[model samples]
Target: MKKFLAAAVFSCFSLSLFANSFSEEMLNIYAKLSVRFVLMSTLKDELSESVNICIGSKAEDERAATTLIDLMHEHYPAGIGEYKIYVIKSDYSNINFCKEASLFFVLSIEDIDLPKVITFAQENKILTMSYDQVLVEDGIDISLFIGREIRPYISLANIFAKDIYLDNVLLRVSKIYKKQEE
Candidate 1:
């Protein structure tokens, strides 16, 4: 009951933030679904720590991240009180820790100044996601890149297979690549 109440409040708060970020159309679409372009759609009625994007620029990742959280809140209004969405700007260092985050989205892959964020993601058990191909080659779990239809596709072959809980919302992946092998 306490957790439910918490989810109710946080969900509302997050929705308010969403209303400020995305367009009304997007808000409406998100309202009807969990809208996971990755693996977030699988889990239900339970809390999951979302992807923590390491952004090099607030201009790029912040809006998207906020919009996603807000959508989550709106979709699960009464049962999603809190979301673990922690963001950190990239320092372009050689390496970093991402294992703690449920999913790690690298917005500034170039700013990180590393040959492989994928190696790091794999080393620590963090499921990596990126919008770039070179980064995907490094072993990111999902690629949330805007392609053919403007919506991103999920790269199942790239994701690290592990014993982690993923939301069902993510499984309904947008089909960006028509014939890509799974």
Candidate 2:
């Protein structure tokens, strides 16, 4: 009985550690994606001097949003004076507010009308990014996928539709998908 109880406790502890590690890995990926998006956007459009990132998510994903926000601020401090981060709640009215943002990060789709949001983003020429691979298939511009390692999955149709251009280096590394033929 004592051995069984000890093993159960150890199993729970191991699971907890694995979850934390995975969360940290995700956070790192998000931060890297944010920086790459900002840099690439700046390079694509010389006229744009600053990058504005809107982090959109449902209420339940507030912790994830906060983690990304903190990581971004740490990497690109306010002293840099070239980028801004905004937290946007899942609200229809907030759509207008996020239109001005250069890039939109969809942290969570639950409780949010993703299709509606994507439509608004497309109409406004905002680059949509997410960690969800399914969103990429559903027309989101950029998605991070982790298989053997973290990799970026991009939709060429969505990218061109938004008039967003990525450099050849990024294009080479990313797995690009196109719309299906009729």
TM-score, every prediction: 0.48, 0.76
Q: Tell me how many residue pairs clash in candidate 2.
A: 0
Worst 10 residues of 1 by lDDT: 30-39
Off by over 4 Å in 1: 1-53, 56-80, 94-99, 111-114, 160-169, 176-182
- Report the lDDT tens digits of candidate 2 across residue range 1-182: 66556534433442233222225556666776765665665333642555667877765566666777777777666613454444343444476788667678887665347888789889988888885677888878888764544568888788787777888788788777666772
List model 1 lDDT by residue over 24-85, tens digit each.
33333432332242235322223364434443213444555455455555665543335444
After the best TM-score superposition of candidate 2, give how far the Cα of residue 148 lies from its true spot, in angstroms. 1.8
Indicate the TM-score of model 1: 0.48
Q: Which 10-residue window in model 2 sums to the lowest lDDT? A: 13-22
lDDT of model 1, residue 178: 29
Q: Which number leads on TM-score?
A: 2
Query: Top model by lDDT, which number?
Result: 2
